[model samples]
Target: MRKYSRKKKEIAVEDYVSGIKSGDRTMLARAITLVESHTNRHFTVAQQVIEQLGSVKTNSIRIGITGVPGAGKSTFIDSFGTYLCELGYRVAVLAVDPSSEVSKGSILGDKTRMERLSNNPRAFIRPSPSSGTLGGVNRKTRETIFLCEAAGFDIILIETVGVGQGEFVVRSMVDFFLLLVLTGAGDELQTMKKGIMELPDLVVVNKADGDNVSKAKQAMREYNTILHFLRPYTEGWTTKAVTASALEETGLIEIYKEIEQFIHMTRNNGIFEKRRTEQLKEWFDSSLKDKLYAQFFYDEKMKESLLQYEKLIIDGEKTVGNSVNELISLFLNKKE
Candidate 1:
């Protein structure tokens, strides 16, 4: 292990903040890469960056976008983000890609899909691997959001891995959640019936160009009917569905307008502050749980005992639940 140097770390953090303030894209990317690193020395450096950036933190609008595979999320973000930048909003996109368990590598092809926005000076694109973490969010994502905010990005967009049960995780971290759907699938209503649609403040029907335009309109009608039966998650705010052609760059302005309206309504109604407080409480709880689990696994005696319990369960000497209970008891009862 390399010896930790406080002074060197401070200098690096200062450079990072300076680059961020001046809108240096390369330095922004390097800062995120450094923060995502797992080594102890890098962790210290990352913390220093966070502390230095804490004072002038960015208060950007955080938007979470999610959908099933093939819903054109990247295309939508690229077009929509570019539109935001054109309107003079600095945008930062954090695209989460699922990790391959076999090789522990990420495809991370979001930048390829978002060609235009990736090259924009006002936009920053980051593709992070899920790394088998729960909630489809990595440990570094929230930190990266902070860094981007500090960098003066007025709009922060988070594109989640559009896999099973991940939208809920994304919802916990963003101010507004948008669910994208493709039209003419006949299953649009069915998709909306799933839990993912329930969480979205706004549902967008993408690919509304070509022959799908009428069908997309019909799908929006169907979604409106379905939404009637579901209770709104945020008080005084009803979830809405709209259509857009991301490929043709149509209807994006209305989408942004709707988002602005939602934010205005929620903030005025005090629901936004309430949701943020709840989110912070959940974050602390989840962090504590992860730390406790790590400590348990790191303890030599507890690790050995866990292995024995696993063997006993496999050999039919104990049931899995009972073994886990005993292990938890042993871990909790241990003295320093």
Candidate 2:
């Protein structure tokens, strides 16, 4: 215990918070590492850091970027993040990579892919493993966002794994959700149309250079039409689709401008605050559900009973619904 105390003291949460407030990138990374740690021993320090972070108050513009596997999301974020840094905005990117279930660890290739951006002093890139969590956004991501904001990043970009369900989870956590699309016509557009079309605050047909420029433009038009039919997420904020060549850095500025316009419109109409309030409510509800589920499954007797119930179901002695009800009764009785 004394050795553990010494190591904890060596990290110094107050020093980390001070460095973060001054926009020190190293300190910011260290803070995130500490928060992401699985050890419960860090909880006290983590809470203290979170408390100090309250003063920072997250004025950052949170953006979620998602697309199918080949849609050039990493490249676009690398280019766009560089643009933001050049314009003097401190940026933090949280890229959620899918973890291999067997290994329970991420490939962590986003940093390698976005080499230049990863090296930027004004930018911090963290690649987090999805850990098979129900939501595309991991449990620790919300906390990490606050840490980034406290560290003075004015722009927070969350890049989700391109899987459709993950995209929706990412959308819920951001102020703006940008969907990257590739050049496609009838079949391809129809395939992507359902999962992503309704959620994106802005859609960009990426890889718009080379021979695909015309096709990309046509796809953008198709997406625009799709957007018209889906009800706008908030009144006075219209979703727009555009084309961009991340390789050539073309149309990136326009995307940023559109985001600014959307933010302005939403804030003026009070929808921005309302959305944030709703997001907080969702976070609270999700936390409650998670706690309840953990308690239900983690109780020693519940685990043993669940195994027994599974055996009974396999042997045809109990119906699945009745078994579940029995488990719930045991769970409730135990609580009582």
Candidate 3:
């Protein structure tokens, strides 16, 4: 694997662009890794290659699917993603997994869960490590989406573990955000948080095909009533509550139809374009922070000074406010 990756990296930027455009999954995976790399050399090469390929110039439907653990998220993706492929659409599943503490690498277990989608030629599945980012998504996810679009994937599904409040970043990045809920968890009114209720483009109750059907319907009804009282996530459209059963493949079509209707309505009203623009702006701002932090954090002098101030705080020799001011002064006084 290491030799193959090294060889893939040696492929020139033009070749990388060509391979990505040709929809070669190996090349696509390697390109995504290059973008996720933190080294200066890899970063420069990735940027150059991305500029040449012009992933941002292409267009695709970006969908974010977030649900709590045990909500059958992977099963839902397998069923829904297969449905998408049957309609002759090229689909990509970017599954973000929690980072393992020891190696800081993802468990990469979603493939086992999404077996059918993984095997489907019409589908491309990539499981990425969250790398301990606050949200369950890594920073390069936006760039990956761009690459997937350029690689001929018309539909991009971003699957994230439900990190509760941390899901906002995923919400901001996608065209449609789907929140999957399971039945019999609890009373929706008591368990659902207001912020989550307002964030999803659509709230779907999964496992609706089993004996849980009645409970699922009840949850849907309860959510619809609760959602009536809150402001809509999108300006023109109210978020819809529905149910699904990934095991039986029931309601997947209905879920997709709702997704299409939302996209159509948002595109016609200009919300879709506006949302994409805002996400790019966010990416720009966040990248600025990373650049600034890299510059400051890598300086040996700054590191020593920060440690000294940190020690003072630990020993109660200085207040955190004073230490912050000292660090700010140290940073500003240094020559650019």
User: Evaluated with lDDT, which candidate comes out highest?
Assistant: 3
Candidate 2 regions exceeding 4 Å error are: 1-10, 97-108, 130-138, 287-336
Determine which window of 10 residues in candidate 2 has minimal summed lDDT.
130-139
- Write one digit per residue (lDDT tens) for candidate 3, span 150-195: 8999999988766544367678889999989977535533455557
What is the per-residue lDDT of model 1 for residues 1-336, given as tens digits with 9 covering 90 to 100?
A: 234566543336678778877778777888887666644445557667777776553457889998877788889999999999999999998865443443454433546888999898888888764354333144466667777877788999988756654576668778899989887535644654356657888889899999889999998887777778888766788898899999999999999999999889988888787877776676557545544655687678998998898899889999998988888898889996
Evaluate residue 318 in candidate 3 and report its C-alpha lDDT on the 0 to 100 scale: 98
lDDT of all the models against the reference?
Answer: 0.76, 0.77, 0.79
Which parts of model 3 have CA positions greater than 4 angstroms off?
1-9, 96-108, 130-138, 185-194, 295-336
Ordered list by lDDT, greatest first: 3, 2, 1
Give the higher-lDDT candidate: 2 or 3: 3
Candidate 2 TM-score, true structure as reference: 0.80
lDDT of 3 at 82: 99
Report the error of model 2 at residue 234, Å: 3.2
